[model samples]
Target chain A: MNVRRNLAGVLALCAVAMIFLPLLLTFYLSVFDETLIVFPPHGYTLRWYARIWPEFGAALRTSFFAALAAVAVSLLIGVPAGIGLARYRFRGRDAVATMLLAPLTVPGIAIGLGIFVLAVLIEEHTEWAISGSLALMVAAHVLITTPWVVRLCLASLANHDAAAEEAAASLGARPLAVLWRVTLPAMRSGIVAGGLFAFIVSFENLEMTLFLTAPGMTTLPIAVLQYLQYHIDPLVAAIAVAQVVFVGGALMLLDRHVKLAQVVA
Target chain B: MVEEEHPARLKSVSKRTAATGFLGPATLVVTVMLAAPLLLLLRFSLNRFDIKELMIETVTAENYLRFFTDPFYLGVLRTTVLVAVTSTVLCLLFGLPLAYRLARSQSRWKSLCMLAIVLPLFVGSTVRMVGWMILFAHGGMLDSAVRWVNGVGLEVMYTPFAVVAGIVSINLPYVVLTIQSAIETIDIRIEEAAQSLGAPPGRQFWLVVWPLALPGTAIAGILCFILAMNAYATPYLLGGPRFQMMAPLLYWEFSTNNNWPFASALALILMSTTLVLTACSNLLIPRRYRA
Candidate 1:
């Protein structure tokens, strides 16, 4: 028994290290003084951190606003859908739920291509100039992110009984009043968790966004890709470290409120 | 009695109306954004490709035929399958022990350990690929360590091995989490029962635990396989331009070659391949083990 426990401990430690080593190395590499990345640096500097804003400012801004837009839109639509699915079961409930999550099952690249093709066709048919627009990218992001919101909201409602809302209704509270006073507040954690995940998903997306972005308009991942093609400097590493810290810190903080592990599990 | 029946009927009507009110917006977004575009893409794939005209609106299976018949395209499909399968298997092997440990551990740090596994996932694949790039680059950590030990630099970057390693790193956490949840469903008493009956540790695991865990393990494997099959950034970054996985190939056709018809066909083929495989695996699992 002791031997088995020791073995499991060793394996678990190895797994943690494997997951974390790359991220730690990324932080280390970001501060390397050399322009060309080498194994052992003679010295370190923080110049790469300063270079990120100038090099990737536009792309970063685009990603930020796009993700924010996606979060807002996804929450607006997804929470109600989650309530509808979780609180009430009607005909075609399973089908509706499946359709909402269909985006996740399909390959993201394919979806990106499909959306891109549709955008072009729309442009050709009409003079809307929809292709390569931020709206188009956010629409796609919403399609992906809404599913997460729906799932998280559904998870949040799973354990909580609907007796409170029913009691409110029985006591002559209007349906909308009951929803506002009782149901929505109960879903708060799920909504917040969903928005956080939606932001991360949109911010980090690359496959679908690749086909949608115009020449001057790009997301941070695309910017990093383009930079990597021509150069292998520490500036990209610095950007990566910044993203990791920001996203990781947000996840930890949110996990305290929402128990994100339970939602995903 | 009439009043009660009237209110009940009204309630039913209101219930449906509420469902529709809640579900309508999401349904509209998904249909307009995702389903409609995929349907249009299907039509586009059937249309003929012309360099000057871009797409000639004539129904044909030329794009699909080209992909099926061409040795180069077939080779890319094979490589994608090989890479996805290898990475999935490796993830299973590496993830299972840790997942079992996590599922059964009584330690106070269990949640912390779980968080550690999941943190990498939220960071996105591109960032993780950058880390691997540093580790596998010619003058990077691996190379330097090899040179110090054996007076020769390692050359692993942009290779299939590097791509597979990067994918495994990206996928391991997901596999562990999925399998952990599955294992948690299993009662520990069953394993203890086996142990009390004089079964060795290995025997207890293989005989008592493995059978119960099969469903979850299968789920984890399928999820990993699908994710790896559709991987873009990992292959694009770690596998380099020479590597020809399906997702990268599809993107190259769309963006670089401007072959929308072929790219659309490739997209459908990739999606169908994953879906069919997932369905087939589900069917293959014994009814007793299936959820």
Candidate 2:
């Protein structure tokens, strides 16, 4: 028992260490006011903030809007699907779940390529042109994050007693009214959690976005990739610090409101 | 009760519409449009790209031939599989024990530990990889620490090994949370009974707990395997020039080469490879339990 306890303790420590070391290192590096990102910086200054203000600011805004649009679209599709799957016994429900999850196993590049082909084909087949459009990018991001929302909301729906909805109905609530008053309120945390997941996933996604993004639609992740190809400096480190804070803050908040592990569970 | 039942019931059309109406839109949108398009896109592997046409106009099997025939592409394939497989294996090795700890702990600590494990799941992979990049690059903490230890210069940046480290670190927390909860459900008495029957902890886990936990682990493994297989940004950013992964190759071909047809073909091949790997896992995982 002692040996086993020690083993678990050590592994847990390693887990904490791995997460801690890089985070500390990144924070430490971000303050360095040097071009080389050298260790034990001669001193500290905030010269890097200037780069972010003028250069990366636009990319940051673009990524934000793109992520926002994606999350909204995902919610539009995922919430209804969540309710449908949760409420009804249907033919081939298992297949529906699997189909939603199919995007996960597909390589991001293939998704990129497939979306690219889709845009071209849509243009060729119809008079409407979606090529190099933000709508297409939003659609692609929706494809990625909707499954997470659906699965999460489905879990939430599963946990609720059916009697509550029935009770509302028995009390003279309309179907829509019951959904709004009882069901929607119940799924609120799950929806927020899933939406946040969708937001971050879309915001930081680089691979498929790398293909789908056009001149005006460059996201922060894509910008980082492009900048890194030519230059590696504390500019990215500064950006990393902000990103970690934002994504980390959102994650920690979601954890407080509802345990993230519950979602995973 | 008869009065209650009769008056409260919705019209049959209303019931049918409720069932089919809300569901059909998403099903058609996801399945018929996106899923079916992917099936059509799979043809890219069989045909060569025509630079002149910007579309795949010919079917020659050259692209697929090149992937199977060329040592360069094949090596990348092997490395991708190796990175993904090794990473998943590491996740299992490290994750299962941590999961066991999570399961055995109190509820508060379980949730706390779980929160710690899963909070990173929402953080974008790019952000984590960026953290790795900042730390791993020269003049970063790692180099300075290494220099202090060995009093020598070491160039660890841009190595495939570094890329693997970044990928593994990002994926570990996710896989652990997945298996941990699955471990949470198992009856404690099962383990205790094996102990009473003269089985040591090792034997107990091997003989009993493992078989029960196998399903969750298998699913987690599949998730990790697919993510690692399809990973693009981490490999691209951390590996720099030397690191070649499938996703980046597909990205470059489609985006830069402008040979959309050929690029589509490569994507198809990548898709097929993922399918084969998954199929293999399903067969082998069941067989492992039988053994």
Against the native chain B, each candidate's TM-score is 0.89, 0.86
On a 0 to 1 TM-score scale, where does candidate 2 land against the true structure?
0.88
- Residue A202 of model 2, lDDT score: 84
Model 2 regions more than 4 Å off:
A125-127, A170-172, A250-265, B1-14, B103-123, B138-140, B184-212, B286-291
Per-prediction DockQ, in order? Answer: 0.53, 0.51
Q: Rate the local accuracy (lDDT) of all candidates.
A: 0.86, 0.75
Ten contiguous residues with the weakest lDDT in model 1 chain A: A256-265
Chain B of candidate 2 vs. true chain B, TM: 0.86
lDDT string, candidate 2, A1-265, tens digits: 6687678678766665555556666667677877776677788877775678687788788888888998998888888788878887767877887887677777777777777777877799999878778888888888888877887687678778778999999999999999899988888766876786688678877777876777867888777778777776777777766766766676677677666656555
Off by over 4 Å in 1: A1-11, A252-265, B100-115, B177-220
Model 1, B155-209: lDDT tens digits are 8998999999888888888789879977876899999999899998888987889
lDDT of candidate 2 at residue A194, scale 0 to 100: 73
